[model samples]
Target: MLKYQQIALEIEKHIEENELQQGDKLPVLETLMAQFNVSKSTITKSLDLLEKKGVVFQVRGSGIFVRRHKRRGYVSLLSNQGFKKDLKDFHVTSKVIEMDVRKPTQEAADNLNIGLHDDVYFIKRVRYVNGQTLCLEESFYNKSIITYLNNEIVSESIFHYIKEALGLKVGFSDMYLHVDKLNQEEAAYLGLKEGAPKLTVETIFHLTNGQPFDFSKVTYNYEQSQFFIQANNELL
Candidate 1:
């Protein structure tokens, strides 16, 4: 990781470890520079990164402060940490509906940049947060890249396994968000009526080497789902 990005994560970790509330002021830039043993420009870059992520905001005269988020629920769209890590404060659990190695579907093949004849790990799961059904996810992992998977890993966090166990570096993802009505199967899994509106996110996750490893579609219960994203103004 880049130095600024590392510092940005460290600041975020500090906020979480200290249980800093929204609007709580972080230490001044001088203090941060002294603490992190970096120069002013580096600290500024780190803060700018955090600001773009909606973690903190700067004031003309006041110090940087934590940004308030939705009180009910939130999911960081920019983060690849998976639900288990992102919402560590909540009870996040996964029920593996199905898991098997299968030939890649056309969509999966294209998204994962694998051949149609390639075998992939097909996984279906329902994720719950605080005992409430949040989303149903269907994913395909390129077997060549992922190598191995099992029931235990699927029931907890595949990303965790891919990172810690497999020792792979996750890079970024391309995501598309849309609103759709639930189908019968999705409705049944979420305990919602058929045709209920839901938020659907389709993503292709790539590794640091720029190889697409996973393709997934996640349908979230609209009433319980809130998504957050932070973008740099330069991207505009």
Candidate 2:
């Protein structure tokens, strides 16, 4: 992890451990600098990241404050942290439906930018949030890039494994979202009727070097899922 990221986590932990409520002021910059033994620039970067994550907000000429908005079923569309990390306050579990190594399909090959003969790990799983079915995911990881996987890893967070275990930097993902009806198998997994409308997300995940490593299609139980994205004022 980067210095700023570690500092950010520390600040978040401080908020949780101290039971800081919404609108409660966080430590001043000078205080945090002394607490973390880091430079002003480092603290600023960490605060910036926390602001982006909606954990805190800044008011010009005022100290930082917590912004603990209660958003049940809400997920950040811009985050690549995956469900487990994103929903850390909630209980998240995965049921692995299928895991296998196989030759890439044409769609997977094209999306992952690998050759037809290259191997890929095919994963099918259902995710539950707080013990309720949330989403059904089918994913392909390029064997050459991802290197390895097992039931234990897939049962938790693959993104965590790719970063913490493999020591790979996860870059941006290109995601497309649309509403579609679920097929029979997908509906069954999500405990919905066949042809039920679902919010489908297709994503191509890349590494920091700009190499595509994973492609996935996720169908969410519409009533159980909500997503949001943070945008800068400059975008408006």
Question: Candidate 2 versus the native: TM-score?
Answer: 0.87
Clashes of each: 0, 0
lDDT at residue 175 of model 2 (Cα atoms): 92
Residues 1-236 of candidate 1 have per-residue lDDT tens digits of 79999999999988978878889999999999999999999999999989888889898797899875645446788777776655778998889999999999898999999899999999999999999999999999999999999999888778889999999999888999899799999999998999999899999999999999999999998877777765555676
Best by TM-score: 2
Clash pairs (backbone) in predicted model 1: none
lDDT of 1: 0.89
TM-score of each model, in listed order: 0.85, 0.87
Point out the worst 10-residue segment of candidate 1 by lDDT.
Answer: 67-76
Q: What does candidate 2's lDDT look like per residue over 42-147, in tens digits?
A: 9999999998777898988899999775665578878777665568788988899999999988988999999999999999999999888999999999999889
